[model samples]
Target: MSTSDFVETSYCLVFSNDKLRANIDTLLDRKGWRKEWEEYQGKLYLTVTAPFDLLAEEAERVKLEKKLNTQANSMARFHFSKFTHYRGYKNKMTFFSPAEQARLIWSALEDTPYSKNDFGRGVLPKFNDQFPFCTAMKSAPAFGLEDSYPLHSPWGKRRFNSNVSFRLVNLDHAVRDYFGEEVAFYFVWMLFFAKWLLIPGVLGLALYLFRPEGVTVDNSPYIPLYSLCVPIWGVFFVKFWKRHMNAVAFEWNAHDFEEEEELRPEFWGEKRISPVTGKIEVFFPEWKRYTRYFVSFLVMLPMLGIALGAMCLSLNLNNYIRDEESPLYIGTLAVFAQPGGIFAGDSPYYGYLVPTIAHSVVISILNTVYRSIAFRSTNFENHRTVEEWEKSFIVKRVIFEAFDCYLALFYIAFYRFDVVALRNELVGLFWGDELRRVGVEVIMPLLTMMFQRKRTTRKMRAEKKASNEKPIELSQAVLDAPLEEYDSFDDYLEMVIQFGYITLFASAFPLCSIISVGFVLVETMTDSLKLLYLYRRPRSRRAGGIGVWYSVMYFMVIASILTNCFILGFSSEQLMQWMPNMFKHEGGDQQFKLGYGRYVVGMVFTLEHILILLALVIEHFIPSCPRSVTTEMARRKHLAKQWLAEHEADASQQKTVQKTEHVE
Candidate 1:
């Protein structure tokens, strides 16, 4: 091996400040680092681990040289990077030189530029070596985690590299549009959801605790309403939040970025469309092209229907199941309600569609408000070509609503139903809405699409974002267009059908669950296939699928809570009315006493919190850099260019080797 062989390829993440370092412990998975201090320049430096192959490449070197990206964007060495390659482990990262790394040692700590991203107060991740504030990683990649790029670090101050995926929303550099800071909107969303959950839940408790052990009619009618409220909260909060998302965009990024600077504001906080006509309004100029001025639906009509439908559905299902023998067995179920386990006269309150109207109308109003405002603003900003505008408004609306469906699914997936609702709604949820059944059938998949649309089309001025071809629209067109224009609908349908069949490979435990799962597989695949193969490609495009992961959370929640509900309800092992009942029954009874409801509640809350925290932690601790390796290579080009420039110039009139820029 040559002299270079002794220098292990260490990939150091360059930081402009301690802010990045503070987040790194929680944000990264691999743990090896060396922070070097520059004695002469008074700058701080860090050396990270990498395979040798990546280090030797000049492209990689220059890329890694820019640490922490604060050095001006125009500056050469101020960003995050990759450096070095290992000769032995071609599969791993290459790193930087070692002697240069020793400078981070405590004895050597002196004046050097340091990271603002870090705070010394928090926990430090275990790593191999420590040098004053800088250190070497203690461990390599976790098993099967090497490919995790930009692994999450436990460091907390919110680095871009952290696993949390947040949209900038609508930042316009000209004003304050910080969505996170919108306390009023958050309060409304929280209050509305709480209202639905709490009212009924409180009633349930009042009924449960204060009734003096009622033999009277279980006037727990509030249960279904409460159950219905969870989904309503899910839907309304999504729509309501989005209604103000533009405001967030303005507050957060308006100072830093202007998505559209074409339409300057006449006033500090307002825009003037017709100074002559006096049209002064605040709107999301980006979506103006896609917003239609007027589209109204009968708001309360569906709500009355939905509420009645749900109540009736519950009452009817109760009647239907009354005489019928339930071949019900205990098993884990999805977040949405479905039935199994023999219970006397248990109702499958399957018609959650009643609450559907409540949520949908609220959502429609929110959508309408924004659409009306944006459409009127079209007089001010030409966000899109007129022809494109005609095709865009509906696409945008459908995408939002549909994508909301997905976000709802995500909440349902992760949280047990009651937690997703107000604390009081758990009973009505289990008894009346049969949310599990309704969700599995109507909500989960709806939510899946909701998220899918959200992912694909979540960009600002989304309709005009040119790189994206609208799959939602194209799929719609393919189905609704003339047969002469496209001939392969059959083949398209077949592929989607196959997708459904493939999904069905994972079936449920019981015949009903198996059937329901199979049904869902077909429904999801067929609906997708129809979208892809059936109507004029929906003029609407999906924002894409940000909701998919959340949908998975809903699935998990449903799976867990349903399991708990099922096992408790079905097992011969339920708690009795009293301790004496357990011993005195002709057959032993393992009945649960009512006092344990709090424990059940605790379990669900802990489960939900831990899961979210786990994800947050994973994202924070595992250091998977978001940008591709190519971006890193681009940063390395400067160093290599200088080295080559000196290499060629050295031969001029007997130049010394010391004149070259290759310091190593």
Candidate 2:
């Protein structure tokens, strides 16, 4: 608490102009901190001194204040930790005093200075210099605060308070302001899907009520209606979301953010003089870049082929296991039954369950390998920006992920959901992927928490032993090491894949919406926790929109329509039975045709085309950008032109006055 015990910390505050610097100075002066200033490396460094006890106490209090406000805004009960309670007790009498505690509370509630700027047009302020202040509590070495000094939520470490309700409008603005448009776009994309997930829930309820009891492939009257509506719903949702996201981007000044041309830090090249600028720069040959691209394709194609082949094999094995007549199934059953097939015939569920579990394990391993290779491949390509790298990586990932759903749908549609024959034709597609998706959402967060706790406990033990002999200060790395790091991209990808499952295959599995709803509800909280506490803040990458993910979603929408058509037309025995046998050919001894008749094939093709055409028409009519945004842009343009004209006229008048003075 004495001056000798106090730590002096220096922070560099960068400002574009003196006005902004003065504003910061005034704000700091008001807080009653003793400070001195120095100029270093074209930046102003403000040095402040405070007792260690006071700084730590103040930092803890500020953290609690943020938590309480977030909880209040979210309409949730405050989660009280010991630090929060301690702060509460300390401020009990001071809280009512307007001069001290009120100002602190008000400051916490105020919007960040940058939040007030007009996108691309107004003065933008930033914490340009890296300074270890209150914001740097976790990383600042001088503080020596324990990694777990401020207790996080019982749920986990979070970037934001998860207990509160998330308002899309607020989140959109805040993320756009803080992290830039690229990150915000992903957030919006996930939220859009999360919000519309309710529609399917409602649809599911309606279907449940109207659907006939004991409905099978032969008896369901609502199959065609469900098929038609589900696809149309997907199309509309995409169209609506496109318009909504565009409006948000325009508002955030992210709609036109140009990608910077600077090379990424990871890019490697020899330093040389630039021909155009006459400046030294690192340069990589264009031909080498192209060669890397070719090599990447060569590497990825074989991996992709293997994955596809494995997927087919897995699907086939799954279907084969389900059939009692298949040799593979009989052989497996006999192996178990050599001990009298203990409970083999009694439990039919295990037949499908065993293969499904194996299939899940195979796919999981393949996915992990593919993702690792894809990331390395992208890095090898040496893209100049994070956006380029992400887009390239996403492309590779989407192709493999989409294959899982598309292959499943293809088999179900053309092969008439006959597992035995389809298993032989190519592998069989099953709904087990849905279970895998749900399991991942439920299990990953818990695993994250478990790992984090183990790390924290180890650190605590190490600290206790160190303290027993001699006092030691916590290093920045040690402070940060125990915390989990997360990237928004992975979270967004997970949610998008989940959305694809519900949108594309919901007709085949009505309960998909229910599962998705549950996953998303949990995901919302876990993601918030991860962002707020578990991870280091990611670098802000400005984005015009959701980039490749938008295309991915569109692909899902189209895929959904086609999938439902197949399910209704080819998979439904009732629909197939109604088709005429005019084009159906009779084979030697077989009474049924090997495949659909020409007439039925024609009907399926016609239905698919008509649905596609309808979707196109709807999309065309639905504007991608809101009318209000267009009007606002026009108004701003007009005002800008008027101001320019007036300024020019004033300059001309000033020139005339100077000419008159010279003549005199």
Candidate 3:
């Protein structure tokens, strides 16, 4: 291949100093890595490429070891649109995506021993410690040209050939090609969710627009009906998502692709021979893990208390806004004086609006703070696998973030029985959080990139002056080096919280799904652009599905059923109006007088039990994998085994003939 082609397909490791470059170069060469070095702007850039033969060998080993699905043939190399193909037999050339090649290359590099110790450190960790100025170790595509024309070429320009499209499948392919299956799975699930959301989005819009006459939002019959339908929708949404995710996983050759989990490098424990692998591995005591869990819980309690304090402060401000006697009531009056009908002339909406804004802001800020703590706590727990650590982190996030996002809405809906405030709270939570996310995730990143670019450029010029070399433009690697590390946790958490808004309190505000649909579309595009342009290309990771997110949504689906049922029986005024006289007007204001207490409890439980049963039925009947996908997967496995048997038989016959000839 040409030099530019090799660079396009390789990973670039940029070093700020040359102290460990020679040792690193020798290690890479010994590990079968084909590398090229370029000195630019007084920095050393190493491009490491996996040789074709080595890549083919690694591909075969991975395919057999992991049982990765493949349909390999001579034509495989020619089809770019097909699921990626690899060399199935010896002396065959096959097309592997840059992502696939990167994985194989890294795996090879990771296997390089840095010491004679039994539990050896890899070249990467050893060199990171050895070279203080080593930086910018990322795939070439992070520094490669986009499809769009650019004015500069720090290296010879060769654009990555891929079209960006809004099509879910296409987007999944693009993301998987660049970022790997773990990140791609999230996008696929999100896009799939946004697509399915159209059903509820349209239904919610219709309910909002065509309610019966004299039906206020609180007393609207459509609200109860919509609330009931949403739980059922959530049930089927998750079931169908399971099928779709399975199909996608099958197509990607990763269906049920479970392997022995690798321990995180940070894990510390007594060394022991692993029962599963019979290999020397670190093992932490289970009792100590539990102790750490308890300690983490204790630390988290104070933070949760802080979250509760913020919520109470917001609620107090809300009550103050409504109570004209308070001194802060003057500020509330100013808010009521606003021109819009929703805000003008002592409107009740104004009471919830200002407080909800403050609540959302505090929740967002608190989430940022709690996230750091959550990470530290998860790390402290010292989970063995990355998956285990992530699961622990996800559970912690769900607990804190759910309280931060949903507790107030629950208070308004169940305790206060104020549908108006609940709807307003939903609107504020939805939009306020969205606005905050856009600022933090997208806008702020762009501004930071601009500032960092200027600062780095000046620093590079200063270095050039010290060397007395010609002035050179800063490279793409240098630009991306200062950007924040990309992770999908934040994006996944945001989606889960939004899912709660649309599903849990969907009855309170029917437009939630529609608004979220639009937001999701915009989010998909913005996230794609963010990953492509604004952040470093994250390392490739394997994943079979969306992982812990699926479980979170499953629980949320059940919670939606319970929440909606309570809203219908306890908070819904129109439902009460339709009920028998025996249950109506049991000594409360019109807004709160939904029913007699005992009957309402019975009714709520009855509906909740039925919905819960229905959800179970839906989950039971709908298979996780589609029949077609399962059949195709079976065919691939059958063919793989058949091919293996034939090869073995042929080799055996050849050995027999050679032995007979030698005896003669």
Q: What TM-score goes with each of the models? A: 0.26, 0.63, 0.82
- Summing lDDT over every window of 10 consecutive residues in candidate 3, give the lowest-scoring window: 145-154
Residue 207: error of model 1 in Å?
36
Model 1 — which ten-residue stretch has the worst lDDT? 143-152
Candidate 2 yields a Cα-based lDDT of: 0.53
User: In lDDT terms, how accurate is model 3?
Assistant: 0.69
Off by over 4 Å in 1: 1-305, 320-533, 538-590, 593-615, 622-664
The candidate maximizing TM-score is 3
Sort the candidates on TM-score, descending order.
3, 2, 1
In angstroms, give how far residue 38 of model 1 lies from its true place: 74
Off by over 4 Å in 2: 1-163, 166-181, 269-287, 321-351, 404-409, 412-416, 419-478, 577-596, 636-664
Question: Each prediction's Cα lDDT score?
Answer: 0.29, 0.53, 0.69
lDDT of 3 at 32: 66
